[model samples]
Target: MGTKGQLVTDPRAAALASKAWPYEEARKLLKRYPEGKPARNGQPAPIIFETGYGPSGLPHIGTFNEVLRTTMVRHAFQAMSDAPTRLIEFSDDMDGLRKVPDNVPNQAMLTEHLGKPLSRIPDPFGKFESFAAHNNAMLRDFLDRFGFDYEFISSASQYEAGVFDDALKGVLRHYDAIMGVMLPTLRKERAATYSPILPISPKTGIVLQVPVEVVDADLGTIRFTDSDGEVLTQSVLGGQAKLQWKVDWAMRWVALGVDYEMYGKDLIDSGVQSGKIARVLGGRPPEALIYEMFLDENGEKISKSKGNGLTLEQWLDYGTQESLAFFAYREPKKAKQLHIGVIPRAVDEYFQFRGNYAAQPLEQKLGNPAHHIHNGAVPAANPPVTFGLLLNLVGVLGAGATPAQVRGYLANYVDGEITPELDALIDHALAYNRDFVAPTLVRRKPQGVEVAALERLDRELAPLPAETSAVDLQNIVYAIGNDGGFENLRDWFGALYETLLGSSQGPRMGSFIALYGIDNSRKLIAEALAR
Candidate 1:
């Protein structure tokens, strides 16, 4: 609480503590526990911030979004309050696997394990003890890579270890009350068969979904008919049974005393239903931030099982992790198309925000996405050039552009030696151009006066020394376009981009020539004329 308590004295921190979304979330918690730490059993109870992961499929960008955003809120709370806080990265691994994910291998093996608890199924990947274990390990690895401070809790382990014993009992005691909250929300057919408790079959090891025939609140047991038409009595406690997802969500809130959590907008109804059940169990529901879901390029909701959106690895391939975080920080309530195409913009904006952070005023600095992305420790170094500019450079230089070659051209524009940040940007630009840009390039053949314009611009550039400034070269190009009998200057520049770069859009002509060189521009014009 050293500098944390001093947030009021530091105007920058003070500004952020009042304005930022994370700060707003922090204020909610502050209101919940006004004394900073609520007392339980005469001891200060640590506020719990929870994020849930279902290990049915590999962790995707949506998974990262929830955890990272939660971490940001957790950091905000730590910066403004002296109360101890704990982040629970809860894995719902004990839940049954309903279907095989399209992204995973060995689908035939996975099909055999349908309806069984994920932790009990054999790992199709053949790496970990079970499928859920493999996914849970991957989730941990990614979160660890980001240096997230949190405790990983497995639902299977929590149940088997009796960590949720009392909570399970509470569910049994309030079974009818919990069902009262959920039944009306389901379809008539589903409502007739729905039960809050799902008992894991001792014989088949599958989670049974049949309706509960009886509930014994005193004995903590449930009676249900099996698929075999035999009635079985199962203890609601221990790992023998688990509640339905909505009910389970509430049980966790009561058991762990979760103070704050965030969910996608799609889960609004579930959150509402769960809150009702939590109240029935005599527990207050956590404060929630409902964020919009990410969509694929087709505008369909991104699914982890379908694997339709950008994966974490795919995004990191073309952008820095900070860029991804920046993307998450912006407009959390607004839907965004999460795809490979969006990476370049996100990267450039991250660089722009980071570069401007130190020079920004106290209030602006606090409001900048870079401030929260880096957790108030924004890096001093910025990329020498934007990712968009670098992509254009790569396109003009072609696929043969090596890192050193790109750096040599960049040296002409950037004043200092290439920092590692710039160096990484160069690599990402090259990779993006090779994969996405190069395949789509189609140089338009010069028609009529377009040929004359290219020739005149080529000649105008021929006299300019390599030392000539981009501005001067730009002026020369502008004069050529103006005198070339083109009705509009935009058409002239469009001709230049399409004829020379094989793309409809390009960097500034002067900057492109400076980087691509005057001789190369001449050669490009010559090639276009020949076509």
Candidate 2:
């Protein structure tokens, strides 16, 4: 790792450190901590990079994107600076459960716990101590699965342990200023009842949003009216109270000295409000990157409560984790539609970038998404076959094609023995084809000139040897299409795909024939003509 005032020696790392988005983020950190550490109370402290999670529901793709992107930036910073750093995967387990999500089970049981902190509610799954603990474990499991290096901190644990005591005091001291920053953002009704602190009700155990009657900054206590119309005073420290989310965000920045964080574009206004509160609390808000949000297939914003977007598990079922990372790494500022239909393209593009990494020049290699996805440890070789080709192979081979049969046919095109990567790709292709492709396939019977052309093409292929090259077979098909009185050759190819493959779009006819065998192609043509 390069130290302060030390030049980056490796050309590729230097190029990437200067060009990649992660490195661009890293540069901001370098500016934040010029001497390799931030000064805290006249003592040097390790720089903190934090990602927040709301354990109100299961960890979704949005959670993964934040941590993954943050990790990328952390890695880039590590490469460019010798400063020690900490990545805190913070979970807001103390957050109130506003309502039941559409996805989880035991809805009635969860609904009963509404308005309580997630950590105080019983787990619906019955596997953990509380609902928040269950979701927190899930968050750690997936992050560990991705091999992310970080520390997990729960909000309930931190607050109950008095880790936020000093910060809580700071919040009490700046209560009026924080309220001044927050009130203008809320509607009249909400602003009327809003307080910087939400006291957990002593009798009902619900987080309350009542009006504060008195504030004692000196004693770290506040007097508020309970839902029963009783006046109560409680210390705001420890687990007695939690700040409103926007104020809590600022308090967290003050408590942890967070140096850098990123949020969705939708939170741009909230971020500004939190920054103002942070300033009021005598702390600087962290530098932030506002990336565009992911949208569902219908272009609606993906929400965890609605469970509208694809989960990490769903994406992993059909594509490699590296492919998903590649998707997250590209043009994060631009909105991208995330759905099952995008998997094949993402998988193919990932392999293409990986395959091209080695031969690329130093600058180009650094610029490639694969380099960052792999942390500069990109594999030397990738599977030669594309994900699209594999899907088409599965489609043409019919529903009963076993894995062994797919491997057997793949041997004809692959020069060397099949690698494990190829085997995994084949499995993904099989599942995707079975679930997504087969149901949508519509085979249309050839009509008009298409019928005669296909017959002529089948007859023309009969004389060709089984071992003919794909190029030669392609030339024969192209010639037949050209001479068969079809004004547009694409129509002939379309007819071949629609009639023979049962899809309007497919792999190269030459390659499909070579893999499926000339006899099989002829039989397919015969069957289509007969139909």
Best by TM-score: 2
Cα lDDT of model 1 by residue, 199-227, tens digit: 88888888988898546776778898887
* Candidate 2 global TM-score: 0.92
| Model 2, runs deviating above 4 Å | 1-9, 39-44, 105-108, 213-215, 304-308, 447-456, 478-489
> lDDT of all predictions, in order shown?
0.86, 0.87
TM per model?
0.91, 0.92
lDDT by residue (1-531, candidate 2, tens digit) is 345856556864674456778888888887876666756687667778999999987777888899999988888777777677899999999998998977778889999989999999999889999999999999999899889999999999988888988888888888778788888888999999898888999998899988774467766788998889889999877898898898899999988889899999999998999999999888889987899999999999987657688988888889988899999999888999999989999999999899999877665666689988988899998887788889988997777778999998888777899999889988889888998998888778999999999999899889988888888999988998998888799989999989998987887788888877888889999999998
**Model 2, global lDDT:** 0.87
Pairs that clash in candidate 1: none
